[model samples]
Target: MVENLTEEILEMLGNESRRRILNLLSKKPCYVSEISYSLKMAPKVVLDHLDKLEKLGIVSSYEEGRRRYYSINRNLRVEISITPHRFIASTVSETPELEIDEFIKNMENLLKTPAGSLREIYKALQEFEEVERQFSEILGAVSLKFNEMFERFLTEIEKEVEDELERLVLLGITKGADTPFKISEEYGISYMGVIKALKSLENRNIVEKLENEDVWRIKC
Candidate 1:
């Protein structure tokens, strides 16, 4: 997987346009027109570079009708300087086939709640770190008392963090920008759930939401 990623990275960097395309996309997601305008290049030229980057998995694009938006592959770390280097990313094979009994046991563990040892449970949950990473920061962005008060609510914050996790995943907003009110309406999550999630995240020092407004920010 590392070898494949290295090959892809090298292939991606071989073209100047592709490198520029990554530079434009890294700031935020953008459509072809946006990239072309930003780089002062033609749309067709941007599209060509986008295709090459996407093919190498250095970038991923989503299309909405006649328009396509491109972003750097969140999973593929790209570092640009006088020379560019993209981290070799591992490929995930088909979800490792697990026996029915094993799958059921895994589900049972996930369902077990606060009863199990948190350290072990969290270790198993490491796979989800990237997705949940922002919540920690959100809790930190709030108030001090709110942060301390909330952490004590659960036996182990990790075991009960799921509802908040699902909410954030569904909210579809980048971290530290969107407010709780906006997220609740967009994700169909309750006002209470947002509060509770923020509280839980605060307890863990994962994020902080300002007292005056629901704007959330992740802790550094």
Candidate 2:
């Protein structure tokens, strides 16, 4: 498993386009057209990279109408370690014991089998109900864990930025100021000072300026 994970990570990093896609997604969730425009790549090419990233669980997407917005999978962390003997790459995240996709495929195949008696069908239904209950419990646990991890992550980020001005600037952006000008006016800071703080935030990947727009947005 370690070998397989290492190979997967290597393959992901080997492509320049994939790396660029990750960089952009890290800053903000974006639709395919947005990513393609920002990277100056073809839409088809951007989608190909997104597909590979999604398969590896490094990226995830959600649909809004006809557009799908892609973002990094914050639940999983990838780590690489090198020792004298070998290099290892691994993912640290919660994984279900029963693979849902495999379960669904098996159920579909089972449907082709000969019909069983009513008693057998009843027993199967009971078993399926038990499995469903267990899955629900597992999903609840995963959701709680993810929320805890996210809160802890936010706490760490808060501690990392100790500057009062920067924090205020971040708060302003979080409050929905799209540009530094609004933040500056609200905080009574000079425009240049706001820009400086914004630049720092951008460097830390805490905020991103949308392409073709003068507005900035908080990444979190």
Q: Which candidate is the best by lDDT?
A: 2
Local error of candidate 1 at 75, Å?
A: 2.0
Question: What is the clash tally of candidate 1?
Answer: 19
TM-score of 1: 0.33
Which segments of model 1 are wrong by more than 4 Å? 64-66, 77-220
Residue range 88-148, candidate 1, lDDT tens digits: 2344433555696697577656545345598767865663464345644563444444544
**Cα-based lDDT at residue 14, candidate 1:** 81
Candidates' lDDT values, in order? Answer: 0.61, 0.78
Give me the displacement of residue 53 in model 2, in angstroms: 1.3
**Scored by Cα lDDT, where does model 2 land?**
0.78
Count clashing residue pairs per candidate.
19, 1
59-129: candidate 2 lDDT, tens digit per residue = 99999889899999856556554433224467656574568768866874654333688876777777777
lDDT for model 1, on a 0 to 1 scale? Answer: 0.61
